[model samples]
Target chain A: MPVTSSRPVCILGLGLIGGSLLRRLAGERPAFGYNRSTATVNAAVADGYDASSDLPQTLTRAAETDAVIVLATPVTVLGPIVDAVVEHAPDCLLTDVVSVKEQVARIVAHHHPDARYVGGHPMAGTAHSGWAATDPSLFENAMWMVTTHDDTEADDWLAVADIARAAGSYVVPAAEDAHDRAAAAISHNPHVTAAVTAAVGAGESRLPLRLAAGSFRDGTRVAGTAPELQRAMLEANSVALLNTLSETIDRLVAARDRLRDHGDVAALIEAGHRARTAYEEVAAGEVEPIVGVTIGDDGWAQELRRQAHLARVWVG
Target chain B: MPVTSSRPVCILGLGLIGGSLLRRLAGERPAFGYNRSTATVNAAVADGYDASSDLPQTLTRAAETDAVIVLATPVTVLGPIVDAVVEHAPDCLLTDVVSVKEQVARIVAHHHPDARYVGGHPMAGTAHSGWAATDPSLFENAMWMVTTHDDTEADDWLAVADIARAAGSYVVPAAEDAHDRAAAAISHNPHVTAAVTAAVGAGESRLPLRLAAGSFRDGTRVAGTAPELQRAMLEANSVALLNTLSETIDRLVAARDRLRDHGDVAALIEAGHRARTAYEEVAAGEVEPIVGVTIGDDGWAQELRRQAHLARVWVG
Candidate 1:
């Protein structure tokens, strides 16, 4: 059954992700958004989004509606945002889109136990930020990873998946620690590597770097990401991130040692070749597709045919 | 004085670089391009270039012309190609467009002591290969790093620079060692890193990768590079490349350690910020442009004045 409601959906924190969600939801539902900055709220309003800078008014409005409140703030701000949402929207289904999950899970467990809350981290973003940089397609084809703790309700987890599906993201279920470790390996560590490479090259000849064309520019592009947020993510998921970093360092060291001792350049090149081949295999779909796949089996096909035949007989 | 030339230019190995050079030179001077493949020679001829599959005819024609012979083969093939070019174009100034300088320099010294061979590596390439990928603008805005050994004549070195400039590359002078190190740091090692990152990610899950939107795809896109050439480069510059890779890994490890120890994620992020800031500073011409800067200070000021004058000139 469709849980149809005319009440507005309230989004807390009108940053890039929040703004984007509001922009998409406004087409279907009565959407309202609140940000700390009045200027940002005014800009959003001017851009045809129903938004306000008044947090109290926003929370009050959220409490009255059968709306789901989404906290789209940084890891540090998540706890406080959840507290505020709990005080205001006592009956609302609370959710957060913070990258780190353990801390958020703990916070919800301690404070907002009465309110249903699900922790989500959508694996998507650009190097840019703010409401101006928000795009509706940002979440499209993205993995919305949800982490469930012992305190998380089954109903709330399902609701979180529904929200992710509605936002055009494939729901990926993972434990808090597992998600953090995986994220560190792929995303967090890579960002740090890019930054360090840029730093080392920058220390060398600044002149040659300026002349750096496509490859260098693209490689270090993510180094331009927001400092404070990156720091928070690193701090929040420190242990896992450090482990991945160590592994990466060891790989490089091994390559270096082989070059110094063996003089076998071919072996070094083969490593790179193997890596590239593996990556291509994944990208080309020679391996399993990451997103969900719907397969209609022989039994399903037979059932469909039988149903079609029955329908045809009834029509005749 | 322009060396009065009755002799045609001989281009050995008519691949993309060689074929492009042949096509360009055919329009301006009498040129002969030799390819091992009869089909390649026929195709070049059909494309209106003066090319031959017959080695003796090509060598005899090369000997007859006061031609400069250019070797445009891979590093492994450079040794034999140099021997052939030395045997044929003894009096002609010889050059090459090989990526590595040290190996080519060593080969030229050992086999072609009598030939005027200046080592050149054009920092320009497309992902594609073959004669069909040849473009006139291939060398445009490219840095043509030239290396001269002790035996190289000043006039021969000057001739190579003149060719590079005419082909639209700004020639930069460097030692073979320096060029190799720089190429390893910027080009070779980075390719390996991209390849490894891609491979690791691919090994984990192809589905998540396919669902990988912009940033992940863009970051690892270079991993799709030709495995054979990528490996060859790694092998050739293994020592220098390993050093670069080690340095990069150390920085990444340090950043990760700081995060792990809960030392200060903010500081690490700040380091990243500083690194990116430096990169931008270098990129924006606050530092010297990598491809040798064309405009002098006086010329730049005059150009600015000229642009202002043009605005006034047009208005008036």
Candidate 2:
């Protein structure tokens, strides 16, 4: 059975993720959203979405119904939203669509200690952002990380996982810090790497730029992401990002030295090919599934995390 | 006017590039190709194109007609092929589709110094290789590097440039050394970086593997290229590859250090975003074209190289 509650979902900040979620879940549940921009709110309302520019009023409505609240704002502007949540909807089950988990979890724990919170990050996005780019099917088949904390409640975890499923994603349960580290490896560090590659390709001459083809274009694609938005997530996960970035630099530098000294890049290219093959196998769904763990058993969070570490998902 | 050469083109090694070129240029100008594999030759001949496995006979035929001999084999195999060209077609205007121009230029200079030669590198490929993977339109609108050495003949250069245009590409006039350096900056170094990124993403745990998305996917797409082919090109351009790799490493290390020391990746991210914007503008064809230069004048090669340095194309 799907672990779900009938409580309404209140989405804070109707940007891409929030607006999409509201669109997907609006008719199914008593879902509503808040955006700071009146123009966006009016547009959403005109499109028959229950959206408003009033933050406190939206939070109060969510609190009155004991709703599940999703924070879909950028990490930079999250503090004030959390503050508003604390003042008006302290009893709500909290979750987020933030890129980094530990920072948001820390903020929740610091600002509203008694709030029932489970951090979430749906691994989906396009190069575009804002409400205009929002799509209802943004999270289809995407991995939504529902994080586990020492103080995480079973019911709260189930609530957020239900939201993730409703948004059309598989749930990958992880601890807050582990989520950040894995994200650094997969997302944050890749951003920095892409940025560096793009900057280097755009060097002192136009020749490299003219000669660049598929590899350069694809490798440096994410470097086109908004600088401030990238900085926010990258800086928020600095510790893990720093470690991952250093590891990447080490690998690149070693490859360089090998090429300089031995005139061969076979080892690095071979290893990378093997890794890419591994990814292809998983992506093709050729790998057998790991055994599943029940939600809310003794040591269930740890067991779920272990299974997730093994690349298993709980599509609850 | 389109530079036209009625000379037949003989391609040695019917791999992806050669096979595609043969398919494209077969009827336009008398074109035939030779592959070591009998199956590939049979397949091409069955498709109603002139292809053969007999290298000596092919070169001898080309010798009688004074055809342009395009050395389309890998760099490692070029020495013997150049020797064959010297033996059978010493007076033929020679060229190659090699990835690195300087190495092929050096080989031609050593083996057939009196042979009129220009090196060409077409910036096009799929991950797949071999005759089956060949597509007739691979070079459509692609940039094809036509290299100039101190002894490069105007008519010889025009012959290769004509072939590139006939195969549907924009001609980029560059000196052999400059082509290798530009290629290292755009292609070879990007391959190494992708390999490192893929290897790093596939660390000890499967979490990163499962979490890999579009950025990681595109960033490491070239890591999936056949290892031997990548090694051939990367190793051949070791000097330029080493320099570009070191520059990338330095930039990544600085980004890492900044993230560690001051919690700021703004400079790097900002610079990268600006560079990506520049690429976008150029890719969108918003950049103005440089003034065209005449093909055979005093310092014409130097003038064409200068225009190419400003991201101009000769499309002749």
Give the TM-scores of the predictions, in the order they appear.
Answer: 0.80, 0.95
DockQ of each: 0.30, 0.74
| Residues B1-316, model 2: lDDT tens digits | 2346567999998889999999999989889888889999998998888999999999999999778899999989888898998899888888899898878888888888787888899999877888889899999888899986545678778889899989988888888878888888778888888888888788757877877777788888888899988898899999888888888988888888888889999989998898888877767674334465666777788888888888888855
Residue-level lDDT of model 1, residues A112-170, one tens digit each, is: 87767777877888887889988877787566776544444655556665666667776
TM-score of candidate 2 versus the correct structure, residues matched by position: 0.95
lDDT by residue (tens digit), candidate 1, B1-316: 2543333578888877787777666666677788888888888889888888876677767777666777886677777776776666667777888777887778887887776677887777655667888887887766676664444455666667666766676665555776677677666666656655544443243333433434445555555556666666567776677677777767666666666665565655676678677657644532222331232332432332233211110000
- List candidate 1 stretches off by more than 4 Å: A1-8, A147-159, A162-166, A265-316, B1-10, B14-32, B35-56, B126-128, B131-137, B148-158, B165-168, B207-215, B263-272, B281-316
Q: Looking at model 1, what is the TM-score of chain A?
A: 0.82
lDDT: worst 10-residue window of model 1 chain A: A307-316
Q: How far off is residue B74 in model 2, in Å?
A: 0.8
Alpha carbon deviation, residue B271, candidate 1 (Å): 4.1
Error of 2 at A239 (Å): 0.8
lDDT (Cα, tens digit) per residue for candidate 2, span A23-54: 98988889999999999999899889999999
